[model samples]
Target: MATVAATKPAETPDEQTLREDLAAAYRLVAHFGWDELIFTHLSVRIPGPDHQFLINPLGLLFEEITASSLVKIDLQGRPVGDNTQPVNPAGFVIHSAVHAAREDAQCVMHLHTVAGTAVAAQRDGLLPLSQNALLGWDDLAYHDYEGLAVETGEKERLVADLGTHNLMILRNHGLLTVGATVADAFVRLFILQRACEMQVAAQAGGADLIHQSDAMGHKVAAQGRAAFAAGAGLSWAALRRKLDRLDPGYRA
Candidate 1:
């Protein structure tokens, strides 16, 4: 019989927190059924200047992930430590491009959720039809799909397409969001995903849509920013608690 290898020890506090947050995000996505069979990705920046980032191991379902199982990799898409698990190179390419080009992107999330992809395929793409859509008004960018996003040469174009936007609709593909913190990114994705779902459902009803004016959109977006800021701390704390209640094993 083959012998089992020894497992690694527990993570340090800082690393532990990062892992827990990342794992929680994964679980949250999984709970919502947004995960695409390990095809999508959510990445958090490492705290140091080593330019390392953490991502989910390729074979594990999002719900199966624990804090210790997240893999750390350099900006160049190379594994930073002794992570025996493989990563999805295509997903890494998209993430690495953003991380390398955008210093502000501390966490990057990409998803192929049904609603998001449905919106991406629409000609207008994320219409300003709802309050949630306003959160991305003038803030959402678009990047035309270029195959599977695995080419190193695509990084430049991807960055160019993203520009200064915090959210992007990967045209004919899916959605992407970046933030200064994990909570920020996750929240942005949540709003964007909801907006997409609402749009698709509204379109299915065959009712004429009411589009918000640019001024109204901007005003609502500013309010959203304030609201998000005012409640973010508590909200994140609550979200972490929810994760703990559901699966305290993530912290391990």
Candidate 2:
């Protein structure tokens, strides 16, 4: 069985900070062309024992999501307050499963990108075909597709498939990633998505692809874990600056 390097918890950001960070993530997803017409979801768990989290309001594009516009919801995916913003049912099923089951997974991100879904459709899953793939090679997990994720029973299977890994390719569905913070999850999804893109491009060429040795792959995976453990916040800060230049409305 594979294991992910455990991440030490950083000081918990207040609810406002988490909202801003998640809002920034939604914008970044759109900025990178990862949004699927607002079909996918990104969520961050709020601190305290209430098990509440924030998600994008339904019917809004990723670019249009702002910190104040996010909706706070409970583990059952129901809104916690008088906020009546529509929530995505599928998003609730997928994200609530992770947030409820994993204490380490403070933030969860799921996406339906062309390359990610294409790779998920393959029987072989993500190959160690690129440095990006190798970065998450050992940490990757897969959940067999069970049609649309609106069914609540699928939560058990989803958590089982995800196990301890932070990076997952939902077989025949899309990609899912979790982290101790929004930055951790987003950085992981970025790596996993890039790997899928590289795999798709390489396979399209119809040429023999080089496979790295398991020993070397492990080495690279360890290097990646260390880099993320050290710099996820730094990467996310830089990304936030980029978002600031692009459209700072997400912080509103």
Candidate 3:
């Protein structure tokens, strides 16, 4: 629970949208059972030049989160409000690294879902065994586990390993994905988690694996991205619609 220096209050429509999108992502992650008992974090950059971001209050479960309940913090992982809930220091370590180094990482998602962690523990990492795996292809990064990721010193190494990749598998830990938008990050996680599950299940059967060629994998990933960018293309509007149909209270 580090405290951030207070700054003058500022408000805008873009900030509001950022807050709403971040909240929607939390709810969606919870819906998919990717949350880890209020531990895992999903963060989005505020619509400003300042290195500000929004994350869930530490005490609240992902499903219980609402836009108003989300906490704002600086790059140093300090809470910006009067709220008393402790922020996860380790999450700051992981998120700040990406936010600081990768300008395109507008949204950073980390999860401890069963399938994700199970895949991380495997020696071969994410196998190109299925179409879902191809979405990641050779673009995925891997980082060796270093306890709970609480050390500031780990940031450099983490960034080095992540090096221009959006998907990262924290070996023996969990998974991380970054995106230019909340929708993109969510879709990436969805595909990454699916790939992990497929790999685990395929291995469980102890049968020979059917791997995709590198060129085909890259092509599939390119096509998937193109398909996503088509039309409204996984826009926050669509996600909001899904939330409204299921649990509309995330805007509260």
Pick the lDDT winner.
2
How do the residues 22-79 of candidate 2 rate in per-residue lDDT, one tens digit apiece?
9999999999999988689999999899999989888888988887778888997777
Note the Cα lDDT for every prediction shown: 0.85, 0.89, 0.83
lDDT of 1 at 157: 92
Our tally of clashes for model 1 stands at 0
Task: Rate residue 155 of model 3 by lDDT.
Answer: 97
Tens digits of per-residue lDDT, candidate 1, 1-252, equal 112221254345776677788888898899889998868899988777788888988888888777778888888777766675778988789999999888999899999999999999988898888999998786899999889988888889999999989999999999999988888888889999999999989989998989989899899888888777546556778888988898776665
CA deviation > 4 Å runs, candidate 1: 1-12
RMSD per candidate (Å) reads: 2.6, 7.3, 3.5
Candidate 3 lDDT over residue span 32-104, tens digit each: 7888887999999886678888887777788888777777888987777654356788878888889999999
Give model 1 RMSD, 1 decimal: 2.6
* Superior by TM-score: candidate 1 or candidate 3: 1
List the candidate numbers ranked by lDDT, top first: 2, 1, 3
Candidates in order, TM-scores: namely 0.93, 0.93, 0.91
| Clashing residue pairs, backbone N/CA/C < 3 A, model 1 | none
